[model samples]
Target: MYEDHARIPPPPDGGYNLNALKPGNIRHYDYWPEPPGPQTFGNTQVIFSDHEKHMVARIRQADAVFGCMAWLTNYAILDALAGLEAVQIVVQKEDFLRPDGPGWRKTKLLRAYKALDKNLMRFNIPWDVGSCDQCGDPSIEGVRCMGVHNSGRKSASPRMHHKFLVFCHLADGYPEPYAVWTGSFNATWNGTRCRENSMYIESEPIASAYAQEYGTVAALSEPLDWQYAWVAPEWRIGS
Candidate 1:
């Protein structure tokens, strides 16, 4: 991890919006207080805190969820995923990216990983971790990378940098591909601070394609090691 990086970086511009990609009622997460109005990037609508809310709301409605996230440390989104009842879910994430640090502490990332494991265990859900070849962290084992095969090779691209979520059913009980959420947004605090855009596609074909892709990636990935003997519990959520 880049231990010298700023904890809260300056916000960037020109990102995607969820509403602009598909036509549907605007989704919002009520758990957190409402944020400011929508932001726009040229002709496209841009959502910041609202985008996070939209994602939480979508996760609330899903009967099953499958996704790939390049980074994850957002508590609200994690809670939403953990709270799902009777829903089958599998999320693939990159553990070696953007880890929190104050000179090699990495306390935030360790806590996030532990929280995710706790949540998954509570609900009996499944999850996977990507290869560490890109990170070159000898401590972590690279079972199988998601996007690229044989990522262990020095010439190969080692990161599975995809950010997407697919919901198979809504509250109305659709069979599958109820919607697909994809964007540049990461589920970390820093990700929200930056200018980002996301789109929700409600097409069966498109969602189906993503769902299939998720399956293939998941097949190549490895589940979290519950023992986690190599990692220490750094901190607790909301600490």
Candidate 2:
């Protein structure tokens, strides 16, 4: 897909027409490692000038704003949509799951979920859940969350692999927001100490495609033969 674009016609001047030599395949250009130059560094700086402000103002006033991979800063995006009349939220199950078992962390998550639900309901917004095939145990459908291995082997791993999903949302006419992150970052205070980067963009096509893929995975989740680690049933509730 990295071919060059079609060449332009030669100019009337006798001088060699460089435009005529333009590569026909626009995709052929090498784009690895974005061209380097002086970099800007600081916090709370006015990066946008009057022209930029005017342009963005028009854009924001028009219809929608799309964003992606916002990670830890996702809460800010949610706050932006909170006042809207209605919004649709698509989120990965792991985003709400507690990594340290069912303790204070899990309780906090449940409470947060309840709060979010209440807030969204007030605005007539709805939140949807999405899961990956890797979640739960494979031996029995929906049995994986119970923390049991499908295999009879007594030495099976104890922890179940939970699928992480990106959250997306749409408010007003704007497209849904999406965020993704990697590494050791979890939904915990300690995880926030690690280095991380996230981006936000506005694009309907991208959001739609992601939402569709998430829907497909949510549908395909089923029972399998994968082994799962088991934890005490008592730990499944509040700490």
Candidate 3:
């Protein structure tokens, strides 16, 4: 649990903006409100580094977790999450690299992917790379470009536009139990930089639903279809 670490650490540069969405509050950067000195609201904490930082810290405190992100560009964040008991991450297909062109763009993208491959192989974590030609239903699984080719309505730029985490919280008295955390944030800097919201809920029904969805997405993944520049040895393409 988070009993040892300081859950309420110091705030980020701009601090927490409790009301960033009120009226035109989030519109202009210069007009953003400053923390009227150190602030606290009950036990609620705000991490200013973007949603991924909060997620990494939270996952570190959990017994286990399942994660799904549309974009996977942050190696530092992924490296932290690799220490978790369990992890499942689904990202865009290798085509995401095409947009980066060559040189440093491609090199950096491959480096980040190699980090993912290392975590999956070394820790035996469940992670896949996927992307579709077009977008699909946000409510359903396999919206990412790697979505199982929908023989029905194939298109380009199918995006996995969801960001969610399911975990079992560890406690002193009760058994580690299931909980869900989801939001409009990716595991990237854009998640924290852009205005986004995340929801944390713990319920058997909700957990079960998301867990099943995670499985569905994994099943739809074609690991051998698209290969990263630096792929795990165990993931060598199958004939």
Candidate 4:
């Protein structure tokens, strides 16, 4: 199993070569304005080019399918999820809250909300939110937005702290799962259109670990202590 710490790479440069003593280190490296192509990494080069065609062909021929478990700190996964079939998501309620206005504002979040809305309708899936007390929020749609409250701990923009978890099962037999630490990313056009890195693991052990975390979240999401202010709008309207 890959430990959490192992997944993150060490910083590129050791903290600052304080001693200007190393002669070779004084050589200046030219900065490239554009990113390098696929040849940047050996593994990516092999995967993207025809040089490893035979090995790629073999992987495609394997009867076993592909599965994924991804953890996204930003909205990077939104684009990836667009091509997928089905997904189950766990997220803080604040992640969906975008101030209503004009322009390209909350477009991504709106898209995600719409997609989620459509999937729930198509699958007849039931959705629920734990009471505010258990969720550590003072309110849901009110002053204390669930999405914002859960994600506010480490973020500068409370808007980016939306907390939510999502799971999607593709129709092609392969399954894709995702777990987000913060519920900030919206599923709108602008939300996902950016430069960000989302980690994906095709290993079963990694996927299972993520699934286990999902279960834990679900079990603890029930709101037993807090009183319901009103039925969820979605539930009330039967949308």
Candidate 5:
């Protein structure tokens, strides 16, 4: 949708600004600029009838956002998530983190968050570990297998796959969600590469519910605390 991280469409912008007005059929803005406490602004004839003129206000009101994906491999997405305020992040990834990994498996989440602002903190959860012998143990898989385990220590799941984003449009000083984005787009290059679609839901109850789910997953993302050692037990004592 956007040409860059700024979320700006390509120049010579044609067609309507999809998000100029919040989705979910929300025709008016609950929070207004004047002193009448939004009554004057919420007037059906004044706001709804002429909403196209209020595009600036709608864009400024956006703050809260959400994204869920089967596998997040996009750097731009990662940087944006890390910079968002008061965000709880949850994502499943297909690749493993290795210091010596190739291009595909080199997306280090912790590093991504830390690189943003040094103080920026985000709960980056990985796919939940599957029930198997290798749940926590760090034994080598095979000659070609990489040692680094997936986040949440979960084995990769090829079946359960879904991608979505929820954004809470909060006005200055207001700490609540007013908009949300969700869909099957992986929030990565997959969004543009594959046949995917997304919908923007602009309702507090709906947005809040999805946001809560992200919080729940963040809390339950405790991975196994096992370390990986090299293959072939080298049992050399104090020799």
Candidate 6:
């Protein structure tokens, strides 16, 4: 409904002035000075809102955030997530792929988090390694395939496909989620351009339930004691 990342309309004449607000100037995590409602383009009604800017704005309001997406390659969202005070991101270990010779390799997502931050630590349980015996283990080379029966490692390959974000505010000196964003919208370039639906639910009960689900996923992210080598070599204090 909105413009793609590559096709975002130009900013105002002087460009975005973070210090001062001006008409038609779009600043990160701020209300649009003049929002353009949906426009009728021939037979289609298109929304011109800046989805990335809106998402970043919501993220900036949270003291803590949690997200899980099947596919995530949006750099803007990644930067915003990293800036959060406290955050946990879960994603399919098999999805962050880039070409590696004839095979595929880990994307910058892994290195970006491990070397600089500790928030995006959890790995979704891999359910994509279907029929490894026939097609071979799809896990990137050098990375251990938890599902493969090599020496003594045997892990479950269950589905973990979820696309949602939970935003929490501090309550009683502890973080408590007040809202959740969930839908089929993945945090990827193609995902933003595709036709998808999302929900921004603001309910104490629902948010808390999502928070609990996030906790469960984070706790049981990888197979017991079998960490995804791409995330970190070994667990640390907070991880």
Q: Per-prediction TM-score, please?
A: 0.51, 0.32, 0.54, 0.36, 0.44, 0.53
**Per-candidate total of colliding backbone pairs:** 3, 25, 16, 30, 11, 0
Quantify how close model 4 is to the true structure by its C-alpha RMSD in Å.
13.3
Candidates in order have lDDT scores of: 0.51, 0.30, 0.48, 0.30, 0.38, 0.50
Q: Residue by residue across 107-156, what tens digits does model 2's lDDT show? A: 65444433322222211111112222323331111111223433455564
Please report the TM-score between candidate 4 and the true structure: 0.36
- Model 6, 73-151: lDDT tens per residue? 6768777777765566656545233223232234464544443243221332111221122232222211111121223
Q: 126, model 1: CA deviation in Å?
A: 15
Model 5 lowest lDDT segment of ten: 138-147
Tens-digit lDDT track of model 1 for 71-110: 6668788677665532332333334432432544356545
TM-score, predicted candidate 1 vs. hidden true structure:
0.51
Model 2 off-target regions past 4 Å?
1-102, 118-187, 220-239
What lDDT score goes with residue 33 in model 3? 50
Better of 1 and 4 by lDDT: 1
Better structure of 4 and 6 per TM-score: 6
The lowest-lDDT stretch of 10 consecutive residues in candidate 3 is 136-145
Which pairs of residues clash in candidate 1, taking residues 3 or more apart in a chain or in different chains?
A: 15-197, 16-197, 16-198
Q: Candidate 1 at residue 193, lDDT?
A: 58
